[model samples]
Target: MIEACQVNRSTFFQCLNGKRLPKESFFEHLLRTLQLSPGEESKLRKLYHIAQIGESVYQNRQCAKKCLETLAALSGNLIPQIYRLDGVAQLTANWASLEGDNRVFQELCHLVQAEMFLPEPKIDLFVPQEDSRFIEYLKVLYRNSGEKNVRLRQLVQFPQGRGKKTRESMEFFDSILFFLASDCMGYEAHYYYSEVDFADTVGVLYPYSVITSTGVLLMNEAMDRALFSAAPAILETCRTQFEDVLCKTKQFHTPFKGYQQTVDFTLENWEGTTMGYQYFATPCFSAYLTRELVDKYCPAGMEERFDHYFQSIMAGVFYVSFCSEAGLMDFARNGLMNEFPERLVPPLELEDRKTVLETMLYRPPENSRLYLMDPEKTTVSDEFVFSLAKGKRIMTYRKRLPKLRMFCFQEQNLMDAFEDFFESLPESSYVLPRSEVERVLRQAIRCCEEQMTFDLSNQIG
Candidate 1:
């Protein structure tokens, strides 16, 4: 097989033995040599990437994968339980004995669980950095808290301010996507740009703490030693400290519950908002929506609100959107606006689709980009829509729910991470490039025209 691929056997063996990562050429050669099926080849490629990048990357990847999957099917039964983070008891015991490295984390988790039982429960967290597993776990805890209303106000410090880069910070930014992406009302974060210069900085005793109803767990810069106490004076002091710090921080994100809130926020922040990249299951229907069509088809009570929302998008801005090929084809076939309520708004006519496509093909809006991602190549669910504005906000909407819910995030690090994530998506023929977008739209227009002609002929007949 090595001779067939004309590769060195020693290098191949080394890669197999986990002593070295396989080169891209060797990996592709091996795939071809085995004549693996497309599915198997895709799996091998993912495995190869994981091997090349190390487990830290995969750890975050798995968190995203799990979060996306959970969010896609989010409903009555599939909702994550308001549960305890496993090993809290053990970790508490370890902490009591001063035995384990993760005792602080476990104790923190236990406090969160205890707070769930209290009326009007609140948690204040001062996080200096991101821990992937812990963040994912906290998301579950907060998300599942639901009606219990366990509000968590987290004050995060970005390492970027210090001009130092690390994998943990990157993962933290990645986790912030779902942290703000969901419908969870309890989770709120405020972030400040600062380096932890505790020696020079006065009055900040510990850099991290989890303040709960049960107790306040304070950890120093290293997180090795902690002071946990339930005394009212101590708790009040910590709470005051947190509030003082929070006053100096900017809000990370905000939630827009329904149509009015979403529209108001969008319109308020519309000016100078450059869309970094948007991922939707279907082509953005709102962008091309006409006022006439909006008036004609908008649901009885929602006409004014719907018109304002559509107008905001049509107002013009620099933006790029990523959509699915299947979704584009679906739009071409049915002209349905999947992002909005299906029952409320009627689908566009064939002529309308034609105009939209022609406008896209010939006089494509300046500073606007449209690309179609191969649905199979992308991990995003059809139910989810993620929109990012450069250094401004990240807005995500889920269509499956009854109402129009959107999470608008203004956190700088989150905006940065999402911008990086979107820009980093591999552009290929499948994930159509911006340059080739006109060609694809032209094809869709032709399809629309062909269908129109067929309908016309049938009507005449």
Candidate 2:
């Protein structure tokens, strides 16, 4: 490969092994030699650019930190900038005036074309309901592509309880049914009922380009005045936020037949198993909520309803989790303590009881398989816990948050990646049988009493 690219073997090896950055020309030549497809070439070019920046920043700690901050600002630009309207009209006019000269629009067009080639590419749209031209363009692209590798998630806002005709007029219902029936493309549509007044924004995200309202044009509102970006970080941020909204928002299912069933099935079997349960665990203000606290926190006139519905749901979940932990404690006392009684140390003087319990709860189990992924990082969330009770597999992906991407059976490669990710989590635990429940409880009570006695003795001394 080095000879073919007309580069020295040592230099090629250095670049290949990340010992050094190759010249831009050499890198392009290497890509050509590898016969990379257009999409792969684009990805490699972006990666190369990032690598160049990374190499420069690696030399200086302050510069690296500043670079990261700048990157974060760029990624989060979508959030703060979306609300700003100052000079939006002038900017839109200027952008629209560019017409054919707009490189970003051209790039979007190229991306729309490239998406046809991707196997199960995701396309997320948050567009105005009246924009027929853009919708038509998408339909044409999908029809002509003749490829089934597409998952489209669209978010549209509607007037509460009176948007049936509006939706039908826009062919929104028709499009959803068409895509759902399509053997190749998976479809999901969310309808946001605006309870409060807010500025309208339109966005469309594909694997390559993210297009959003730039506040640039006044004349044509049909995505003509929107800003487009191919920057990976920005696209990723947009995609992530879009998925967040989709998951939390209500779906437009009234006019669309079988819509609810489709969504329910998708979420239920999302991880490809009915038995597995995934929990994104974060620190709650308090694990156990008192009646007084619930009354204080919950709104008046809604306290009873909330307690009956939402509170009950959460209480059941907390109860199950508490019971699970208690069972583990029992197993520790009866099974673990019997085997390794010397390992248990009494709490030291002035040591907090809470601290001791936490330590005991987090201690690594013996006679079990252990696998650790990377250390917990990222402030987004605490942990992603996946438990397969039937399979006796429990894994916790610490310091990682779930991405806004959709996974289907057809996207086997992506599914495999998820499987590997779940398998890589550090923590695992097994379920104890119902027959052992009584014994587990008894052991747990004894352990608690022993700890109380030890702490009382230490205080007396």
- Count clashing residue pairs per candidate: 0, 6
Please give the range of 10 consecutive residues that has the lowest summed lDDT in model 1. Answer: 90-99
Q: Evaluated with lDDT, which candidate comes out highest? A: 1
Q: What is the C-alpha lDDT of each candidate?
A: 0.64, 0.40
Which runs in model 2 stand beyond 4 Å of their true positions?
A: 1-109, 161-171, 195-222, 253-461
Error of 2 at 311 (Å): 38
TM-scores for every predicted model: 0.67, 0.29
- Tell how far residue 406 is off in model 2, in angstroms: 20
Give lDDT tens digits, candidate 2, residues 47-114.
Answer: 78668755322223222223222322222212221111122222213233323324334434444555
Q: What are the C-alpha RMSDs, in order, of all predicted structures?
A: 7.5, 20.4
Please give, for residues 1-461, the per-residue lDDT of candidate 1 as tens digits: 87866678898778778898778888878888999899998888878877776655455444433444444444233444444455635323312422344776676677776776687788888755635445666777666565665678887766554124333444454566554545556677777665556546777666678888767877765565566777778788989988998888877666677665654554455456646456665766656655666776677776666666665566655666677666677788888877554344667889987877777677666655677765454444566666676777767666554545667766554455556545655433336566556667777888999999999999999
Q: Please identify model 1 stretches exceeding 4 Å from their true place.
A: 1-99, 128-130, 160-170, 181-183, 197-205, 267-269, 274-276, 287-315, 332-334, 338-346, 349-368, 411-430, 433-461
